[model samples]
Target: MKKQILTTLVFLGIIIPAITAQTTSENPYADSYIYWDYLAAYKSGQATVAFNNIDAMLQTYPPQKEIAMPRELALVSLDQLLHDTDNDQTETFYTFINTRMMRVLKDLDRPVEKGLRIYKLYNDGFIIKSKKATVAIDLIPGGSNAKPFIKDSIIYGIAGKCDALFISHWHADHANLNIAKSFAARGKRVIAPKGLWENVDPMIQPLTEHIETDIKFDDLDLTLHVLPGHQGDVLNNINVVEFHGEGTVAQTGDQWGTDDLKWIDHVNEKYDIDVLMPNCWINNMKRHLVGFGPKMIITGHENELGEHSIDHREAYWMTIKKMELLSDLNMPYVLMTWGEWYDYQR
Candidate 1:
C-alpha cells in the first residue's frame, strides 16, 4: 500500500512540475526530474552502488520547487531504510540523509526579501532566514553515533550562512558543541542553556528564563523572549524570537510536562506570534497551541534521534495522526519531513 501511494504520487508529480508558481509546485506534486537508478539498485541488493547513485544525485539535485513529489519519494525510502537493520551496520543510511541535507544548504543561498524562509533539517533542526539575517535553531549533524551524519564542511557551510544559532536545550540531538563552536568562532551569537557543554565551551550564552526577560541581539537585529521550559526535569528553552520587520516566531524546544504551562497558557496574551514551532508529540498539545496562539504552526521533532527503536524514532505517518487531532482548531501548520522547507510571509 505504501509503495502504491509513493508510485502514484511520483507519477502525478512528473506530470505537474512543468507548471510552477515561483517556488511552489502548481499541484504540490513534483518535477519529472528525479533519478530512479538508486531505487532500482536497492531492489537488486546493490546497496553500495545505490548509495553512490543517491549521493551523486543529491549533490546536484536542482531545488527549483520547494515541495516536490520526489521529496516524498526520498522520505519513504528513508523510512524503510532506517528500519532495515541490514543497512544500519553500513554507512548507507547516514549517507543518504546527509546528502539530502546538503541539498537544503544549496537553497539557502537565495535571499528572502518579504518574509522569513525556513528550511527543515533532520528532526528539530531548522534554518530560518530573512533578508536581514539567518538563524539556525537546533541544527544538528545527523546520527547519534561516533560517525557524524553530515560532514564538517556541511556544518560550517550552514554556520557561515547564519547570523545566530538558538539551541532550545542541552539534549544530544538539539545541541552540538562543535556546531556551536563554528557559530561562536565567527563571533555570531550561540544561545543555549548552561546545562550540557557550557562548562566545556564558555562561548555558549544562556538566556534568562521567563518571557518578561527579553534578550537583545543588537548585532543581529533580533530580540528573544525565552520561556524556561523543561523536558521532564531537563531545562528546555522555549524561544520567542522577534525579527524587526519580518514578525515574531516562537520555537518550543522539546517542551514537555506541565511545569511550563504557567507561562505557556498565557503566551497568546504576551505577544502576537506569526509562526509557532513545536514538537509534534507532547502531553498537552492543544493547550500549547491555544496558549501560543500563532497565526500558523510548523511542527518539528518528528522522526528523529536514531534508529535504535522504531517507536522512539517517531515516523512521519504518526505526524499525520497528530495533525488530524489539531484539525478542529483551523490553525495552519506544515508537517515537513527531513530536508523539506516552508517560507512564511508576515
Candidate 2:
C-alpha cells in the first residue's frame, strides 16, 4: 500500500505539471517562464532566441489590448539590446533582419485572394496586394549600412510577386537599388523620381516621370497617381494607388506637414483613400491625417535600426502616444510591427 501510494503521487506530480506546461505554452502571456526566458535571452544578447520568445508569445495572436504590455516590453528590450554598440553590430543587425524582417518576407509569400492586404516590411517599406495586382512601395531590407542584413535572393522573391514598384524617394532606407533592379528585371514597371540612382549604377536607373502624372497599367488593372510631395526640402513622391473594385491606399514616405498640403488636400478631395500608410514620427501627423481623411491610418517607420541617434530610434510606445493624441479624430489607426499585416475591404 505504501509503494502504491508513492507511485500515484509521482504520477500526479509529473503528469499534472506536464499538462500545465502544455497549456501555458499555448498561452505564452500566462507562462511567466516563457516571458522571463525571453527577457533573459534578450539581455544576454541572444537576439535570435529572444525573438523566438516574441514569436512564441505572438503565436496565439492575442488581442492588441491583451498583448500590449508584453509587446511594448519586448520592443523596449530589443531597442536597448540594439543600442549596446559594444556588442557585435553585424550580429545584431542580422539578428534583427533575420528574425523580424524575414518573418515579414515570409508572410508576404502568401496570396491575397480578395480585398486589399498591406504588409509592413520595415520602416515605410510596404507590399500592398489586391486581386488586381501586387504593388511594392519603398521595399527595402533594413537600412543603409555597409553590411547587408537581407540577401538579394530575398528581394527577388518579393519582386517575383509584384507587378509594379513605386519608390518614394532616394533615401537609402526608403529605396533600394537592388530591389528596384529586381522588379525591373522581372519585366515589371519601376516608377520613381528622376535621379534616384544617377551616380550609383546606370543600369538600375528607374523610369522617371512627372510627379503629378497618373501612370496607368491596364494589364495589371492598376492606376497610380504620383503626387508631388517633399520630406523637408527634399523631393518625395507621395503615391496614391487605386486597386479597382477593392479600395485605394496612399503611402506618404517621410512627407512632412503643410509644405505639401496643397497637393495632399487636392488628392484627398479627388480620391477616397481607404487606407493611409505614413511614418509614425512625422511632424504634425495629425494634421496630415486630417487633410487626407483616410478611412484608416497605419503608421510605419518605428524603430528604424539603421539610424545612429537614439532619438531617431522610434519605439512602440511613441506610436501609442501618437495614436492617443489622434484618438479624438474619429478615425481608426493600427500600429503594426514588421511581419504583421492589415486587411481593408470596400
Candidate 3:
C-alpha cells in the first residue's frame, strides 16, 4: 500500500504539471494556441476568426524567436491555402494583412525620442525617426498581388507622421502610389529615382536626379545622397540619409551589387554608414559589407509575402544561418520583424 500510494503520487505530479504547462499562458508554447487556432479557422472557412487569431498572437508579444518562427510558418501555410483552388476563402488573407497594417500604424503613432528610432514595416519598408525628421522608405503592403491590403486611412495616418517618402525602386512590393500621394498631398517630399509613377500620374513624379547629387530636405534638416544601383535589370536607388546631428544610415533596396561595385565602392569612400539596411538574400553580402563597412547591420526583406515562391520567402532561421556565415566579418547585425523598432544612439 505504501509503494502503491507513492507510485500514484508520482504519476499525478507528472500529469498535473504536464497539463498545466499545456494550458498555462506562461508556458513558452502558449503562443501556439494562436497558431493552431488560426489554422483551424482557415480550414473552417472562417476568415474573421483566423484574423482574430493572428491579432491575438501579435498582441501576446511572444519571445522574438518564438513569434518569428511560428508566425512565418503560419503565413506560408496561409499563402498555400489562399492559392489552393478548392479553398475559395481568400478574404482572410487580406484580413490578415490589413489587421497587421493597422497594428503597425498604431505603433508608429507612439511617441519617440529625439534620438534615432527605426521601425521595420512590410518587406523592405522602414520608418526612421530622428529629432529633426521622420523619414519613410519603401512603405508598402506585402504580398505578390498588386491589390492594396492596407486601407487609405491607415496610409494617410502613416504619411501624416512622415516628412518624406524615399522609394528605392518602382517595384509594387516596395512602392505605393497611395502612400506617395498622401505625402505629396501634405506638400512633403517624395524622392525616388527616375521613371517612378511616370505613367501613373503627372503630380506623382518623384524628384528624380542623378545618383551623385545630394537632395536636401530643409524642413526635416536632412540630406539624402541617392546612389545609382540596380535590382536585376531595373534601376534601384541606394539611399544614404544624413540626419542633422545623428549619423548617416544607408538602405539598399534589393540591390545585388552587380553594377561592378560602382555605387557600393563610392558610398564606402564618401560616407560612414551608421546602420546598413540590406536585403537578407543579397548575394556576396560579406564582400559588400566589407567594402561599404557599416558600423552595424539590420537585415530586411525577410518573408516577403508578395512572392509566391518559397525560395524568396525567407525565414528567421535562414537569416540566423546567414549571419553565422558572415560572423567572420566582425560586424554586429540585428534581425527585426514587422512593427518592431530598434533604437540607435550616435
Candidate 4:
C-alpha cells in the first residue's frame, strides 16, 4: 500500500505542475511574447510612456540564469531608449527597467539569453516590429549547402519570423529558398520581386505575395520600392523596403546600381531613409554612394560563415568611409554587416 502511494505522488508531482502551468498562462510575457510593444510605442511617437512601461517591465524582471531571447530584448530595447535620451532621462529609465520591470520577467521565468549579435545597423532576435504590428522572425539553421550569411543564426531566425519578407533578387547569394520555406511553414507572407517568386520552388510560393511596383503593404506597414538591380533585366527587381517605425532600410538585394546615379537618386527621392542595407561590392557600392543618401549603411550578400570572403571586410569599410565623406556634405553614413535590426523612435 505504501509503495503504491509513493508512485502516485511521484506521478502527481510531475503532472500537477504542467497542469498548473497550462491553467495559469495569464501573463502576456509568460510563454514568450516577441515584444513589439516597445517598437510600437516608439513608432507611435509615445517615447516617454513607452520608455516608462518597458523600463518598469525590465526592472521587474531582471536577468537570471536560463536566459531567454525575448527577456534580453526587453533589456536591450530599454537600453537603447535610455541611450537615445538625455543623461538624466537615461539614468532614470535604466533604473526603472533594470530594477523593476526585469525583476518581473525574471519571476515569470524570463531571463536574458546570451548569443545576441550587434552590427552597425542590425540586431539579432526573434521579433521585428514596424510602427504598427509586431511579427516574430525566429532563426533556423541551414545545411552546409546554405549560402553564407554573417551571423547566420541571428539573421535567419528573425527572417523566419517576418510577417512580410523581402527577397532582393534571385542570385543564390541573395535568395535562400530553403530559408524562405521555413518562414512559409509558419504562415508568414513573403514579398519578393515577381521573377524570383516565379522561379522559387512551389513549397515557397504559397508563402509569398508579389508586388510589381512601388507600393506599400499598409496592413504590414511595409513599403516595397523596386529599383534597378545587379543584372538590370526586367526580371531583376531589386527592392528597398521601409519598415514603418523601424526607420527605412533599402535592400539592394543582389544588385548594386553602381553606374546609375539617377536610380539611386530616385530611391532617395522616393523614401526618407535612415539606413541603407545593401550588398557591399565595389562596382555596386562606389556608384551607390554617389546617389545613396542614408545616415547608415549595412552590407549584405557577404559570406558571414567563411573566412571573410574576398578580403571583403576592408573594401566594405572603405566604401562606408566614402559614404561618410559624402555625409560631410551633411549626410552621415555608417557601414554595417549582418547581425543588426532596425530600431526607431517615432
Candidate 5:
C-alpha cells in the first residue's frame, strides 16, 4: 500500500505542474491582460471591440506603454501569418488581414506624448514630428532620393509625439502635391528650409512655417536651429534638433559641408547626441562623426525601391560595410533607415 501511495504521489507531482503550465500558456490574459484581450478582438475582426479597447488603453496607460505593447504583439502575429503563408498553409484572406493589421500597428507608433517615432513614408518625403512640431521634407523621389520615405516618417514621428518636423528641400520626390494638401487638412504644421515653402503646393501653404536660423522654445525642452551646408559645393539646408530633457538627435538632411560640421561641433560641445540621422552626402560619414560624436548614426535615402528612377536600397548596408572597414561597428553606433520603420529591432 505504501509503495502504491509513493508512485501515485510522484505521478501527481508531474501531472500537476504540467497542468499548471498549460493553464499559464492558455491564460493569454495573464499579466498583459489588456493587450492580449485587444489582440483577440483584432484577430476576431471585431472593429468596434478593437477601437473601444484601444481607446480604453489610451486612457489607461501612457502613450508609449499603450502603443508599444500592441504594436509589438501585432507584429508578432503578422510575422506568424507571413510564415504560414510562405509555407503555403495559410489562405489569402489570412495574409491580407495580417498585412492590414501590420499597417495599423505601424501607425500607432507615431510621436505621441513625447515619444519619438520615425516611419518611411512613400518614396522620399517624410514628416518629422516632436511634441508639438512637425516638419515635412521633400526629397527628389526617384530611387535614392529622400521624399516619400519622409511622408510616412512624418506621421510616425508625430504619432510618437515628437515636437517638430524638418523638410530638407523642395525636390519633387521629397514633396507631393496631394499629400501636402492632406497634411494641411489635418492641421499639421511644418518647418522647412528657406526655399522649401515657395515650392510647396498652395494647398499646404498654410501649414508651412519657416524656421529661423536659430529658434528657441523654452517650453519645448528643446531647441530648433537651422544649419546651412553645401553638398559637394552645392548649398543644401539642414535642421539641427537638440533635445535637452535627456537625449539629442541631429538631422543633417541633404546638407554636408564645413559649415554644417561646425554646427555639429557646437552640438557636441553643448550636448551629447544620442543619434545622428543624415543623408549620404558625398560619403563624408567620417567627418560628421568626428564633429558630432553621436552614439548612433541612422542614414536616410538608402533603401532601394525597384521600379523607381533612383533607389538607395543598399545605401544603408553599403554605408555599414564602409563603416566596418573603418571600424568594426555593427549596431546602435552605426544605423540606417530601412522602411516605415527600422527592421533591425524587428
Candidate 6:
C-alpha cells in the first residue's frame, strides 16, 4: 500500500510535470506557459528584467539532453525574440546579446592552467586560448548587412586579449574586416588566404598556398600549419595551430570543396589533433572526422547567420541530431550555444 502511494506521488510530482512542460512547449502561444512572463517583459521593453528572469529560469531548469524540460523552449523563445524581430527593435536585441557576451569576454582574462580553453561568441566566432598564447578564428562582429552586431569596445577588448587572429576566407561572416583591423592595429599578426581585403588593409597578411611553411610569430609562442582549402571556389585556409606545447587544435572555416577532401582525408595521418571546430553543416562530416581525428568535436555555425532567411539559420537541435546519428563513430562531442566555453585536455 505504501509503495503504491509513493509511486503515485512520483508520477504526479516528477513525470507529469515533465510531460506537461514538453506539451506546453509545442504550442508556444499557449497560456499555460513556462516562460510567457519573461517573453512579455522583453517585448514590452523591460529587457533587463526579462533577461534576469530568463537567467534565473536557466539556473532552475539547468540543461540536459533529454530529461530537461522547458530549457529548450526558453532558448528557442529567446532566439525567436532576437531573430524574428524588426529593425525598430534591432538595437535592443543587439544590446541584450552583447551584454551576455561582455560577461564571457571578461571571463577570458582568467588563466587556464592546462590544455585549451575555447570560447564561442556568435556563429562561428571563436577564441582559443592556451597558457602561452590566445588565437582567434572566424571572429566576426556579426554578418556584414547586420553588423556593428558587437560594439567596437567589445571587439577591441577581444583584440586586447588575443595574440593573433586567423581568418579562414573572404566571407564577411567569417572574415570580419573591423575585427581583423582591431587585431592588426594592436600590432598583432592577422593572416588569411591571398586576395582577401587585398590593397585595403595592408597589415592583413595573406597565407601562401603551400603546406611546407609553418607560420610563426616573433613575440607569440605559437605555430600554424596550413591546409589550403575552399568553399566552392573561395579560398579557405584550414588552420592547424599548436600553442604552448598543447595538443593540436584545428579550425575548419567553411571548407566544403570535394577537391579539398583529397588533403583533408589525410589530416590524422599527418599530425595528432586534439580539438577540431567544424561547421555543423559541412559536407561528408564523417569523412572529415576520420581525416582530422580530433579527440573531440565542438561544432559551430548554428542559429546566427548572415542572411535574412529563417531557413538559412541553423538551430542548436540540428547539432544534437548530427551527434546522435553519428554515434557509431564513437567520437565524443559537445554541442554549444552562444557565450559557452568548453575546456579540452590533451
Tell me the whole-model lDDT of each prediction, alpha carbons only. 0.72, 0.72, 0.71, 0.45, 0.46, 0.73
Model 6, residue 244: C-alpha shift (Å): 4.0
Q: Which of 1 and 5 is ahead in lDDT?
A: 1
lDDT of each residue in 1-346, candidate 3, tens digit only:
9999999999998898777655664544334543332344435445556556645664454324223665555444444544443333256655665666676678676666666788777779888988778899998755433555565677567778888889989887788787787878877778877877765544355645645658878878889988777888777888889997786888889887566475566567778888899888886787778767888888888766644465666765677788888878788876666666777876
Once fitted onto the true fold, the runs of candidate 6 whose alpha carbons sit more than 4 angstroms away are 1-92, 143-147, 199-202, 210-213
- Candidate 2: give its CA RMSD in angstroms: 10.0
> Each candidate's TM vs. the true structure?
0.77, 0.78, 0.73, 0.50, 0.51, 0.78
lDDT of 5 at 222: 59
- Summarize candidate 2's per-residue lDDT along 261-344 as a digit string, tens digits: 765655667888999988887778877888788988887887777555767767767777778877899788766766677777
**Could you give me the TM-score of model 2 versus the true structure?**
0.78
Candidate 5 structure lDDT: 0.46
- All candidates: CA RMSD (Å): 13.2, 10.0, 10.0, 17.7, 14.2, 11.2
Model 4 ranges off by over 4 Å:
1-128, 131-143, 146-157, 197-212, 232-236, 244-246, 257-260, 282-287, 290-292, 301-309, 312-327
Q: What overall lDDT, based on C-alpha atoms, would model 1 receive against the true structure?
A: 0.72
By descending lDDT, how would the candidates be arranged?
6, 1, 2, 3, 5, 4
- Please list the residue runs of candidate 5 whose C-alpha ends up more than 4 Å from where it truly belongs after superposition: 1-106, 109-115, 120-164, 199-212, 216-222, 232-234, 243-246, 258-267, 304-314, 328-331, 334-346
User: Which of 1 and 4 is the better model by lDDT?
Assistant: 1
Q: Please give the lDDT score at residue 158 for candidate 2.
A: 68
Alpha carbon lDDT at 282, candidate 2: 76
- Tens digits of per-residue lDDT, candidate 5, 1-346, equal 9999999999998898667655564544444533332444334344333434433443343222113454434333332332322222223332332333345345545544553444443334343445544344542223223433223443343333323345555555444444444444555445555555564553333212333366565655657566665555543555666545544566665554655565555556765666566664334677676666776665665443443232333343355455666474332443312234421111
The stretch of ten residues in a row with the least summed lDDT in candidate 1 is 21-30
What would the TM-score be for candidate 1 when compared with the true structure? 0.77
- Give per-residue CA lDDT, model 4, range 56-165, as digits (tens): 45445433322244544554454444334232223343343233322222222222122111122111112335435433321223213633222344444445435555
